[model samples]
Target: MTTRTMLQRPAFHWLAAAWPYALIGLVTLLVRSPTFGNPILDFDEQLYLLVGDRMLHGHLPYVDLWDRKPVGLFALYAAIRLLGGSGIIQYQLIATACVVIAAWFVRAIVRRHMGEIPAIVAAVAYVLMLNVLHGLGGQTAIFYNALTAFAAWCACKANDANTPGRIAALALAAMLALGLAIQIKYTVIPEGIFFGCWFVWRLFAAGERLRRLLGIAIAMVLVALAPTGLALGAYALAGHLDAFLFANFTSIFLRQPFPTQVRNDQISQVVACCMALLTTAGVGLFQLRTHAHGRVYADFPLLAGWWVSAFAGFGMLGDFYDFYFLPVVLPSVILGAFALRGERRGFTFGCLLLLWPCIFIPANYFSRHQGILQTSRMVSAISPYVSGHCLYIYDGPTILYYLTNACIPTRFAFPDHLTNPIETRALGVDPVEEERRVLASQPGAIVTASRSVVPRVAPATQALVREALVRDYVLIARTPTIDRTYYIWARRDLHPGPAPLVDPRAANPQ
Candidate 1:
């Protein structure tokens, strides 16, 4: 073949290899189903959903729920509620869409760095990765992962010499995405820091003049600050400056260590977590050595740093859970895919054999097969009956929020000395006093974990609750399962109120 034809053949071959990535993307979207059946799992997820539902009904997020997340997430949730209707299925679908998009971005980044086969493998591994699969229902997990992948893609594009303008645009886009991700979960801050430094380093290495680099840096900063600035402005205009500052900025910065009750101690769980960290670190180091002199892929280092930082950070918090590391694991798989590149086919098969067992064993053994699902369904069934009200729940916010479309407030308890002074003071108040205050002020149902309630409450408080239930309220439903207790209490005197006017398009600007 002529030289021109030889060159064209390689380009054609590369284009042909893209089919697998497209196939993986299609399969990922097809497999998208509501895995957990109900939107509630962890307390935080449920809280956010309730807040979102309230926002849909013309209530502001931080102002009403006293939540810490950025306005962007609330806005997204509000939009989803508008389009999909007031159902957990709609929320699940939106979260699923975010995962699918994130998967596609992962494939794109891998394809750019390693080529088609490895990229396809990485994308599949990303969707199938145990954390991603299990935490698909989580709002922060889904949004943050998607945002991280998009940021990585932008960083990669930014590093390309042939497309400087395109790179600048992509870099700015990445910074904005990073800002949103940071709002969703504070863990994304390191991603922005690492990539910002990398941008400077690349500019210096390329002999770009200082003045031009400074200008570029300024532009990037403005782009990054745009979303955050907008969110702050929204809160300020709504007369919720205190809530915005205390919840989003101060409270998040002062996150307390996890409580002892939620801490995990299983030997296998510990081993699996350790292995995952080791594998990720090993792959990252290998990539650094191999690509040290090559063009920056951007995804590898950002993800590797996210993994190390989140693990170290969450490990310091005593009540760590598996889902806490969900955002970091997506990039780890992509890095692992790069590490497995060029290996013999047989070796790849062996790795899969070892990996499958590690991934499935914990999921099958520890996760109560249908326990969470059942709890979620039961809660959802009773939510409509108590829609325009508050729920006092003792445990698991996920199920409560998923079921009732109302915010369930838990009495905040201080387990760490590091807690904010205000929060500590609030927790210091007697539980009886607090429960009484809530009962008198917030007209709603009170659901308690039967076993926990029977033992934990003092005699006086227990008697008061029983009296209220018998005289003032009626037992609407009771769902008892092997590992959970659900009781729905509706007020007898307060008849079913008018359906709250929920405006789906009230708050979402974009």
Candidate 2:
């Protein structure tokens, strides 16, 4: 039979043909087994985990913890913690399941638009993409991104005439999922904006005028805002309204320009942006030429548009990290896979042949950088040290949540006078007064990025820390990895001491 004849086979027959691909994708996902790896405790992960841990202990994210993230994320983490016992294994399992389910959604969406083979290819590509794999680690952002993709898939499925009810259900689901995504990281805002636009387009295509669209939009807004509004109400009731509004919301939005070290090279930035745009455009052109009228192909533009929106939004923020693009890039992988499938057999094979080396060559080089592997190891090793002591970590939240059963604070506080002057001033507090308060409190320990500890503090505050170390405090240990330096300091007498004289040289230690 001709390829076209085979492609036109009955749905059940097509399912039978595609079963092998599904099985392969499933096995690949299972073997990758999200839980086998240790949890990496980075700043965001640590904070999220801490919030989850606190929730488990009756503290809320924006309430007891001073975080700006919406409450949906914490609630989800709380649910996971309840189910999985708050271990790395449980969290990994949850993350893995989320990815697998997302893959299934991708398959369903693809099957609806493209034929079985293209659907299978899309699913497999999604499962194997570097960003997808990168997200499998125990971070709240991964779950949030997966949720975003799942919501988009639901919307795609619902847009079909045969599935209006399904679409409504999916819209509701998307609304709720977005609530949770926002809670995990506010960055999902741009993603929501992108999806919201698509949702409106879908409504418009359904022959609904502005009035109907407005009604549906209002309903969606209400459903999405319910969880967030409820969380805010709870925060107000707890008498933390100011803290929630100021610290979590306003403070973050008003953050200063990117520091010198945090900024990327302009040339590299332009190059990365070009590569992303070209790849997206290439996929779009391929789709239009090969399957112009295909529903599956049609969805590509919407998905790609959302991705482009997210990338542009994130890029302009100046804190662009490769992983920030994971949510948007994930759908593109499937589109790219389908694009490849539509190519001539020989060309497709040639592209496949070059793919591995293209990825691995650079990855291998990055692995050799100083402290890279060591930093990874330190992050992975955080699970064992979560007992008894209140774990203070600057960069390792994912690790902290998996390992400890203690209440983790939201923001990592520095010594009072040493706090970022700009941040302190922005919050309308005198840095010196805040410093005195923090010193008086005499926290058990302070954990921070080694470099930030210097630049963020005034010379006098730096001197205070050095003097305290020399007299009233002891250096418990110093954990230096390629990407991080963790200094654990303890009181020399395990109690407060006389306020020591500040040495100016302490701040700019040569």
Candidate 3:
């Protein structure tokens, strides 16, 4: 059979086609197992867990607790929380499942160009490459990557459809998938734009009239935006459209820009983390370019458009942190498999060996050993002290709230909003003023990380928290980590003011 025939080949009976997914699922867990249950796995995941927990207990996203991420992201976590108690293991497992599903999509998409064995290798690499960029946990990209890949697959189906009705069905499905992905992370917008144009162009190529195409374009756009529109509608019904708008949209612009040098350094770090990927994937693309008109050239533009759009977003949104690279991982790896088109299984493993060293660098930042396990010890220490009051995290992990079973005294509970210099002005509220309020509220306990370790510390806010610590709170427990120590401070008024200190003579009427 020809390559295109293989692409369009009917799936085997369910039993025959089920093994790849089953194998990929097991590989995902085995690779991701180390980081499971690590609450402090990623700071962003920590916030998601906290939001999910708080959301269950009558709190809302923007109004009740502040974060600029879309509500869908929080809603996903909230759903994860329902799997049981706190959602640490649950979210990780769900994220792993997402990775596995996404890998399957990757294999399905690239198989036409790169045959079955190499295509499967490409899929496994996507899962393994995630660790190279800290995608081992519940990063927003974890969920949306799968959704975006599914959307791309739908678009591919549209490309393959011979019947008009089938084409329309696949196009709408792709648009709706992209729309849901937007609710999860706005970064996917660039890729969505590509898919939108792809649909319009495909319909135009199919000889649809301009007016009908216009209507189709409008419908696709609306479908993609519907989830976000629904989220806003919910907020509107509660009469807090402004709060939702500001938190979800405006607050991001409020953040201070990083210094040029710092951003350059971040870009450098991302590049370093991706070194092996670049070497191997880069060589593959070069090989394809040299051999463009060969049999491995099916639907090349579709993948290229998706890859370039995501890559541009990654480049332009520098310093948004490295997880921005996660979405780029999908297309790059599949495209990279272009090198293995007619090669043996040995070449697949050879390509993977190049990515091995790159994995360990970013992998160090997260691990079951490096993350929440150490500081979780402080939970037992701070739990008794913070029994009935909020536990303020001045410059520490946000997961402590979930761990210690304490409330956050303020909405700016995500520490970066207050403690990170780059976020000094980004949150709608004043970070320092918010910090003052948390300290002033006399929280049951406070957590702070070593300045050396948490480099994003805002000097002014750090000073303020330090002064508050000396004046009103006392150091209770210090937890050591790979980098430095994280300190827990308890409110000094642990005693009940010495029972109001009444004079004996006055009580006796002397």
Please give the distance, in angstroms, between residue 468's alpha carbon in candidate 3 and its true position after superposition.
Answer: 1.0
Q: Rank the candidates by TM-score, best first.
A: 3, 1, 2
lDDT of 2 at 105: 66
Q: lDDT values of the candidates?
A: 0.57, 0.54, 0.77
**Superior candidate under TM-score, 2 versus 3:** 3
What is the lDDT for 155 in model 3?
77
- lDDT winner among the candidates? 3
Model 1 lDDT per residue over 456-494, tens place: 224444454555555555555556654455665666555
TM-score of 2: 0.73
Candidate 1 clashing pairs? Answer: 40-398, 40-399, 41-398, 380-403
Against the true structure, what is each candidate's TM-score? 0.75, 0.73, 0.90
Give model 1's TM-score versus the native structure: 0.75
Candidate 2, residue 189: CA error in Å?
2.7
Model 1 scores what on Cα lDDT? Answer: 0.57
Model 2 poorest ten-residue lDDT run: 360-369
Model 1, stretches more than 4 Å misplaced? 1-18, 34-43, 112-115, 130-134, 162-167, 253-255, 259-281, 287-291, 296-319, 341-350, 353-391, 396-433, 441-444, 450-476, 481-483, 490-510
459-505 in candidate 2: lDDT tens per residue?
Answer: 55445445545654444445565454555444545534642323332
Which is the leading candidate under TM-score?
A: 3
Cand. 3 Cα-lDDT: 0.77
